[model samples]
Target: MKIVTWNINGIRTFRGGIKKALDSLDADIICLQETKVTRDLLDERTAIVDGYNSYFSFSRGRSGYSGVATYCKDSATPFAAEEGLTGLLTNHEGPVRCYGDHTEYSTEELQLLDNEGRAVITQHRIMCQDQVKTVTVINVYCPRADPEKPERKQFKLQFYKLLQGRAEAILKDGSYVIVLGDINTSHRTIDHCDPSDIDDFEENPGRKWLNCFLHSDKQEEESTDEEYNEAYKLTSTHDGKFVDTFRHFHPTRTNAFTCWSTLTGARQTNYGTRIDYIFADCQLAEEQFVAADIMPEVEGSDHCPVWGQLSCSLLPSSKNPPLCTRFLPEFAGKQQKLSRFLVKMDQKSIQSEQRNELPGSQEEEERRENLNPSGAGKKRVLTAESIIPKGKKTKTAKAASKPQGSLLTFFKPKITNVLPSTEAPERQKNLDQDEVTSPQNPSVKGSVTKDATLVLDGSEQLCTSSYPKDNDQGTKVKTPHLTSQPTVGPSDTKKGASSGFWKSLFHGPPPPPPCKVHGEPCVLRTVKKEGPNMGRQFFVCARPQGHASNPEARCNFFAWVDKGK
Candidate 1:
């Protein structure tokens, strides 16, 4: 069965994108990241296909934040591990009490909050028709590099540890585990467009975070320096424990990147990187794998969908049997004869038409001579008399006598010019006589003025008046209000003198309260310097705006805000 993973950005915003992906790929299983929607917001019909079952886990943050969902074609449920452990750990405190004597908790009460305050891990167990047991798929979106301070390094490491523990538990189960979705990490020099441009030695919290999974066993031996950091172990570990589906499936392909730079609009160019991935268990390596770079054609999302297929045996009972039937001899013979007769008729008609129109033939010369007779003795032949059937002559004569133009167009101007003065005024007078009519007109008119009401009504009535007569007995005629004309004001005249003052003060919503660093607001506005990136306003730390005394107190909490732009 085909399986696909995609970071859908926001489910509501990119709902169409999800639908498009599903229609194009038709995958049996789909894992989506950053759905940013709770169960209440999902459309049952649009989000879940008729025969498929879906499960979703939302982030603890407010609406429009990190969330993940999985859609399976067959019967499956969310994998609920033992001990209230939802295969994810967060920075927030765990449950103080247990529901039952057993350490295991129900999936209904399980919660997996994001510890790094970045993203949550959502896992789904899909049962294939092949009865190949359960396939656990985990969707992940990791934290990004924070420029506010250096404390993010520690938090990133902790987040990775939590993920590693979950992975180990899943693998120990001995089922086919597929860790897919946007891992938000790129390994190897080929994964990035310009790997050398950025300093590899610089402290990157996200890179360190990925190392937790890539170098789980050798974390102590790996160098702390980002340059020497071999967390992903591009050469060995991937092939051993996990399989990089893209590299393994499409080895000869180059520039097979998923995430693209929205600013440049180029496919796998300078700013493009392969941050999205689909990692499969080593056991499934022999099964044929396929990875498609769908970034070039699709729009809306920064990361494109990556899909793979696994060949597995289906259970005998699941296979559908062919239907058995027979055709009647009499009906079959009649159908065959009808088909042959039509084909012969078509061929005969084609030959007859061709022979009649042949050039230099007797029939062609005679037809030409009849059309252009040059002899003085030749009489003017009336072709119409010969061509017209006996009784049709009277009908044709009557049709020729009538005017060629349509009846509606012939008297259009006259009808329009006469109706308004004669019928419209009386009809409007009768309408105004009833108090109920004007009130109903207001509801129909919406925000339109009286003149607009009259004009629209007159156009519908096909009135041709240059100036309609005022039918109201008490009201006086007034000039029509032109909505497009600018209103002159005393304040508008003074604004020219104080333009600079207003321009300086009006800097668009005061920069979104500054990004918080270490639980306090930071002064630096990254959005002002960087411009709009996605729909977020990024910020760096300046002097601490609140509790922190040292302006340099580093913290990973410095983040971007949506601000409802």
Candidate 2:
């Protein structure tokens, strides 16, 4: 499962980036901070995406102030939602003082951080291994302390303390926790573009706010009307119930910023701060990380999208065949394993022998003159005009029978499927008619083409991918090459242990299926339909060598893809 946390700055203006993130990364959940739009002003487009459920917490007492929103993919569900600091509202010290403003807020307003909707927590049910567990994701748009206003700065600190306490309380309920969003505090100097850009360190309360959460300055402070927040804690600690996911993975890394200041032109100059983050519990952080990267390309917001993938024990789709894989009878057994290069070689050898020696009969006299321009029989042809109905031109074959139960791969080869390269060589789009017939509305008899979408995978069958390169740098972005035509045949054996698996998977078009009746090769054919069997591919019987068409040709046996695998 992939999760993305991005400070969109404002939902009204930033939804475009949300769409791009969804399309580009296919994240499971997207947490947006500083969504300035309220429910009343939220248009239909902003409230919902076609395949996701959206939840939002709009700011109170203002049209556009502070807000947070979470988008959950259709596959996941959020069972509960809590707005603001919930019970923490009653635990505040008292009414606080601000720098410039003399006016003091009431206890309720101060506790709730002026009802700006800085946070919202949603509980999602996730399937982990064999059991179902809950994950509470708290999306927070923590207030940024205003340099000119002392009250806002104090409120920001208060909000931070409340958020930390609430997160701890949620953990007590036994659910995995992911506290995500724009915390609005640069925890370290490396978090921002440059350390020298910072101003006051000792007198700055906002600077102290981040250090407080990072488990620094652990000395006990004297108690007074002002209650100082506790020292920072790690996700594994009871006191520090959250792990900074990014920082944990890249402890010493620098120059990874999530938010930029447009007014100061920080983004243009690459001088921004990494304020937004996805903080999770220790267990999830340690064992479930799949990828952690800042998507600098996603546009339409002051802050770029930051996303990470986790191999959570949810669905087992990652281990199964690709969702697009399908089966057809024309490619049964030996049919899909035949290498195109090998087939051409075999055909070339047969053509030369036939051209040098003529048949000894009148029946051979008719077949002697080479019908194909390529000096070879187009393919191992097999089909009886008598067996085929007089008027019908095409046949629709059903898929191979499903296994008795769910397929559990006992010895399935562990091949690292690589994403295709963008600069792959280009070639013709259409499959050669003689090599692999194109299935049409009125399909004619021919060998099933390698380009058909039908895919059959059994214990011994090979499954190939066009993209075979490794990406050690990070998570790989899948290329469009595999979905295109197969350009290269299987590569020769390689150095790694998985080299054999790679060889099998990257093989060319297979030889025709074996005929059960006459031990001849069954010619593969494609079945095209406007309905379910659009990409169907399979094979029919081709008479064996030295055998011409006869009245009794029962060798034309038909089978579904990989039926004998």
Candidate 3:
């Protein structure tokens, strides 16, 4: 079974379809990090791919940031799935797969850590050496520490600590653990492109944490078993050890980086860091592990994919699994499309047409058919009351008339026509003196005339139409009456016109000048770091992020917002 992990940057921005990209990878299980999509924005195509079951974790704190997703083939469907590392976010029904003890962490701390939607855990029943074993895959996009924010460094360390605790808990529960995704930390000097540039490399908290987490592959001549146990106790909380899968197979493989800096064209020369990894349990790596390696040839994302092969095959799924996207309401049935809402509106219009049927036409016709079943040869008599025009009916007839209202009438926009200032200079004076109640809605009143027809749609919006004078010499000016009829050709034009009007009205300060390198528009950003320039806005290149060698790559554009002021 092949399992792949990639930091996709943004799932929605995939070149072709997301399903096509996943299929091209040809993996039994694929985990994606930095999906950068929210729950509401998830569509059927992305949420429910054919031949695959997916699980997604979306950021509750913000949209389009720090999201992860896992897709498993139909033959390898997981027995259980979960969002967020903390157990508090469980929406799964039936049997639950425990991920270890969370009692050590407070409720508030768990909630805070899980808010970013950085992790998704899945438990699969696999056949390892003829024995059914439960393997928990913890897909995590570890937080990156920003140099400007010291608190983020602590957050990153805390995340690593929590991850270690969870893995150890699962191990104690007799389930093998596989932790994978962008760890965002190079563990050794060999993993980095230029280790000399970084001072006190071993002193970094993230690298130090990783060193203690994984077991030492090489046993020192001077170190004994007792000495190793004592040293391990001082650094880590977890008693169990994990093996870096790729490094386990190729320990001395240098420059085997999975991530590169797009700003400096690092990927072009293969000058990058190997932060992405697939770390498996020590026993799992030693027994069932087949091969593990990185795929630097894939070019869609700044970080390439790393995969691990295992000899174990997933056990057949039971009739009722604890969790799966197929069971979710969004993907259970026919996917909803934009046209579904249009179909509903059409149904409403049909109902209104039925409601507007002649006062008692249906009842009278039914009565005649029932009473004169055998009188087909006899001529039916026509009543004078029925023959009279509806408008000319007596007060009694008018009282008996059914209401002529439809659901659309209430929502229809009211358009009132007023002569333009160029045509009638004193039209305002005449409007003030000759205000008349609207025939449709008497509650609102407006000035109206025969020459200029007023179509009041309830709102005070003016719709002016010129009618030809009664005299034969008068020229005719035809103005079309507007209704809410959807036409493909006009819709695009309407949106363009309306958007331009609103944009001009609310447009703020003119945008900063184009970037010098790419000559593209710049994007505005505000400084969030606490310093003299805190909250200050600046402009940078607007190009899509990519390796500098690429023609479409973002340039080194920078300008202060208040510089010219």
Q: Identify the candidate with maximal lDDT.
A: 3
Q: For each candidate in the order shown, give its overall lDDT on alpha carbons.
A: 0.46, 0.54, 0.71
TM-scores vs. true structure, each candidate: 0.46, 0.47, 0.59
Give the number of the best model, judged by TM-score.
3
Candidate 3 lDDT (Cα, 0 to 1): 0.71
Per-prediction backbone clash count: 2, 21, 6
Model 3 pairs whose backbones collide? 413-457, 414-456, 414-457, 414-458, 415-455, 415-457
What is candidate 2's lDDT per residue for 281-301, written digit by digit as tens?
767776777567787667667
Q: In model 1, what lDDT does residue 369 have? A: 14
Could you give candidate 1's per-residue lDDT for residues 1-565 as a string of tens digits? Answer: 5677777677667455455656665777677776766434555454555555454554332335556666655433233311112433322222111122213433322332241123323233333444445555655665342444344444345445544555556677665666777766676556766666667622345554444344232442243223344434542333236666776655445466788654334342324678787777666654534343444455557778887776653221231111100112231233444443233223444444434332322112112111111121122233434558867987878777953444333222221112222354465454442111123222221122333333333243332222222323634332221121122122454556556678776656345354354444544333323334634555455432222333443343555655553
Instruction: List runs of model 2 lying over 4 Å from the truth.
Output: 14-21, 87-107, 200-207, 212-239, 313-565
Worst 10-residue lDDT window for candidate 1 reads 319-328
lDDT of 1 at 288: 36
Worst 10 residues of 3 by lDDT: 365-374
Candidate 3 lDDT over residue span 258-369, tens digit each: 9987754667768789999999999999999989999999989889999999999987566435456556656677676655333322344444444432222211211111
